[model samples]
Target chain A: MKLVVVQVLLIVVVAVVAARLFRSRGARAQAIRRLGVLAFAAFAVVSIIFPDVWTRLAHVFGVGRGTDLVLYGLVVAFLSFTVTTYLRFRDLETRYTRLARRIALDEAEVRGRLEGGPEH
Target chain B: MNTSRQVDTSGVWLVIPLYNEAAVIGDVVTRARSVFPQVVVVDDGSADDGAEVAREAGAVVVRHPVNLGQGAALQTGFEYVRSRPDMEWAVTFDADGQHQTDDVLAMLEKARAEDLQVVFGSRFLDDRTTPSLAKRLVLRAAVGYTNLTTHTRLTDAHNGLRLLRRDVVERIDITQNRMAHASELVEQIGAMDVRYAESPVHILYTDYSRSKGQSLWNSVNILVELILR
Candidate 1:
């Protein structure tokens, strides 16, 4: 099967999204993500008001139909959403692991003291 | 078993990350405590009374309020050991009773003889430990990936039995709350310029341990976690 231009573009976009998953999180990355959401929202409103604009843009991007373009966009958006959510959960898990470890150690210390002292 | 000629392992602490292994943890702790008196079982929010069993079996039990993964439990155990000024060495032992206490003693001897900071138990260094063919292949692949990525050449990257000095334990911070923590630990250790060696260990994959062991599918999750992290 022959690969199309849209296929290459979509693959590249997906690669970029995957790469972003490993990039260090910071205010700059957060700002960029927020701007992406704002731009996506603006585009959604623009497309809803002027549906023909998607078809025109699809033609410029070498996609056959506006629906296919929207689908590809949705795929990238969903992937980024999943990546960010996963990173956020990892961050939260690290924090809680530290917290739980502190409490567990502290409690163990108190119990050890109550039992007289450490077994060593 | 002679108490007079036995090596001074009072400074050594065996850290076992306990989960829902109430059926076997007590026995494991008791047996290990016979050789290494300082045994710490980090109970990772078990529904069973494994913590009580381990405590009664003469192991100091550290209970997590919620179920964190084995990696987190291990880090907690490490932190706990680090707090004890008397503990000079820490051994990360398995909770499933697969690791042999003799192997731990041998590793400790090797560490002390060579003055090494870390002694990793390697099942593939000899033909003593026999795993299933599929498990062997998966473990080889996992170790290959680990060696390639972590800049550390190890025959067994996922082995649960490892001996670390107090300084090495203090330097380690395992954030991977799952199977990936194995590779994460190795990677962190590799980054630290410390004297390290590997000792041949026999893993007794009994019917009980085989049933409790990690599935081969976790290799994929481990790879993903390492890449993403």
Candidate 2:
């Protein structure tokens, strides 16, 4: 119980420090993301300390041991990050496509405007 | 820093792109009046009175009804030069006076004598006079990438102080606006195997230029622009 309390205190301290550093960059969105990551790290720490919780998860997942449940959690986290990264990539692609279309339209308009200008 | 001491009189065209640069437009125009004969000031849809002052200063003013990028304004100046058969070479100059006005003749002389399709007045070519450390690093990285990708040995790729041959103007068309167009120029020009050289030049890092300068973050945009292109 003492170890758990100390771990929680450490986690909160790390998270707050990490969040402060991130916030200074003027990227509120990224700072929030970093806070979320810190929270996730805290959750992992809690899962690690409480072996019984993982045992319960193992029973639910029909796994043999608590370590198996931990492995399962890791796989889930990995897949989640991968999915999120893919979604982010898709969002970036859409944004860039729209941006390219806008530039193309702008170029056509300017070229037309120039060609239509006073003749030499 | 007048060109009179260095070389004889030569027909040098100064291309100044003005977009709401009216505050300093009169002073810049007045300054250029003494030097360049064919100074074409492209008013890129200035809401202010830049065109009037430019014309008053004996500069051949070209007004774009709407705000176009510097590249477009430059193209307009090039078109003007194209029309003028007497134009031996056209100098790509910045309206902000970040570039040295007197160095124009020197740059042109080097370009003309060397028979280079394009001669870039490089600040980093000689370490004797260089811009800020941050600027130098960014410019070096950009130039290095261009050199590697385009197979060209460009020491400073981002410097706008450049002289272009009358014929090579038709070969290259700059479409990218903002600052990324500098890197793109190397790729396009290199594709055509254009003869290029670098000469030492000075940069005036003024408060005005610092304020007007692109964000260091925007250099990433420039890199991405080159990558995408």
Candidate 3:
């Protein structure tokens, strides 16, 4: 009972902190990533406190064991995180590539003038 | 972009397309004047201080209040030269320094010998040619597209380096206002069955040219401009 109370309090704190941060940032992408981390932290605290909750939920779903339930949840979260991260990286990479090419072209034109080859 | 100054012995006249080439406008004007003798730099609604630079370079400046395309600049130049009896050949050059003076000489030579109305300079025809592989592919594609669409049957369809006879300058109607018009020049002229020639020219591809020019996605914008405008 005591452990459950602690878990409830920690979850509430996580939720409150996450909400505050999200409100200030307006659920911006960075904030959302941070929120995911905080959410996982809150889940960890909950699992540690109410050890029976995992097994109960797992059996309700006809899973073999409580650990299996937690493991399955983690696997799903990992996949989601990987996809989002990949998309974000790809977006950033494209933008940088464009910028780099532009700068390169500018440099070449300037250098051509300096070299005095007279090729326009 | 070549900065070395020379005397304008040739009776050739110059026309430049300007959007925001304020920094280099003076250089283009001065160098063109020293080499070609007569210069016309069109200010395509340059929000910057390009007008002042053009004047300093000793060019007859034509200002467009809004940013028009390079084709408009060429039109303005041609119109100006056609009115002037002293003007013989009009050279269409890029204000961005993609064109060099040596190519201008080659264009003049071809224009005079063939008694042709217009001469185009092809970068690919040059010995060293353009440096970038990506640019080579894009330019090749653009050339092929221009040849097929314009039926000009010229080697270098879109090269800016060209010397135009006063008669050709007076007649060719270049309606497209944006960058796509550069390639479209061949098509428009070909439709009229106008005569033209092409010779090798140098292209100095710097990082700036690639960046500031038409982008991969901008082709859609150009297509829409063609269809709608």
Candidate 4:
């Protein structure tokens, strides 16, 4: 009964997440990402319902257990998420730094002019 | 003290970056102005009156609207100095009062004598310089990393004090807007094949400076920045 409840909960969560991801406005890459996520979620549901199916698939992929395969996939997915997030932050920081430098240079030029110096 | 000969400091400019250094900026600017003819302090958007204090100490002050890192501050100073037609040399000093003004003058003399484009001050070369064992190890690791990547034989990789010629300053631009710029500068110097020298200089590591300076974890972050970026 607990297993049935967990499966239902997982399906509900994945459906909501997949729907949100699909409805969100973004580039074509995002759509492809949503598809990948949905497919992975469906595979997770299948593995949870039919435990032996995972073991059989694991053997084909040369794995000893299905849990190990899922764990490895989660690790890779997490690392990719971290890298993408870092890249986004890095992009934002670059833009901010440029803005800061421009403001600084403009202020210095004005101050120099007021002090009777040549235009910088 | 050798007070016999007066060194000519006619067109040299000292650029000191201050960030919440209200306790020491005033004295540092005053002392630096005594040695260098033109002292320019870049207040990197500090919350305190570091800019006002530095200006009161007779240093030319330029304020950033927001707090950028030390690298951004130094670049601002460099940009300001580059605009002046009479400026011949640019020296980057620390606002924490760890660097000695006399050593700056000595390095200036050496750079002038050797016609060097850049002169970096290294604390490891001086026996009087004292840092904790852990700090020394971190610095040594930094040196090895810098040397390995830049292919330059530098004893200290992250020294705050440096003297650059006007032409050399015009050649390269500082892109790293933080502590990582130290390593970036070395890489640029090597890539550009600029004429550079390393001088043994004194660095007074006070409790305040050690606290304000880079921590070990930041060193790891710097390594990551170097690799990923």
What is the descending DockQ order? 1, 4, 2, 3
Assess the local accuracy of residue B226 in candidate 3 as a C-alpha lDDT between 0 and 100: 50
> How many steric clashes between backbone atoms does each model show?
0, 0, 14, 0
Q: In model 1, which runs have C-alpha deviations exceeding 4 angstroms?
A: A1-3, B1-5
Judge candidate 3 against the unseen true structure and give its global Cα lDDT, from 0 to 1: 0.66
The best-first sequence of candidates by lDDT reads 1, 4, 2, 3
Each model's DockQ?
0.81, 0.03, 0.01, 0.29
Q: Higher-TM-score candidate among 1 and 3?
A: 1
Q: Estimate each model's TM-score.
A: 0.96, 0.63, 0.60, 0.82
Residue range A1-120, candidate 1, lDDT tens digits: 123878888999998977876585898888888999999999999999998888998888888789988999999989988898988988998899889988999999999999988862
lDDT per residue as tens, model 1, B1-229: 4333367798999999999999999899988888898999999999999999999999999999999999999999999999989999999999899998889888888999999999999999999999999899999999999899886889999999999999999999998998999989999999998889899999999998888677888888888888776
lDDT of each: 0.90, 0.68, 0.66, 0.80
Question: Candidate 3, residues B70-162: lDDT per residue as tens digits?
Answer: 666676667656756777778888887777887787677666667777788887675766556655566666777677766777666557878
Instruction: Give a tens-digit lDDT track for model 4, residues B1-229.
Output: 3434478888788888889999999988877777774888888899999988987898888888888787778888888889888888898899999998788888888998998989999998879798888889999999999999996889998998899889877765776777888898888877888789998889998888988777889889888877654
Q: DockQ winner among the candidates?
A: 1
- Candidate 4: clashing pairs of residues: none
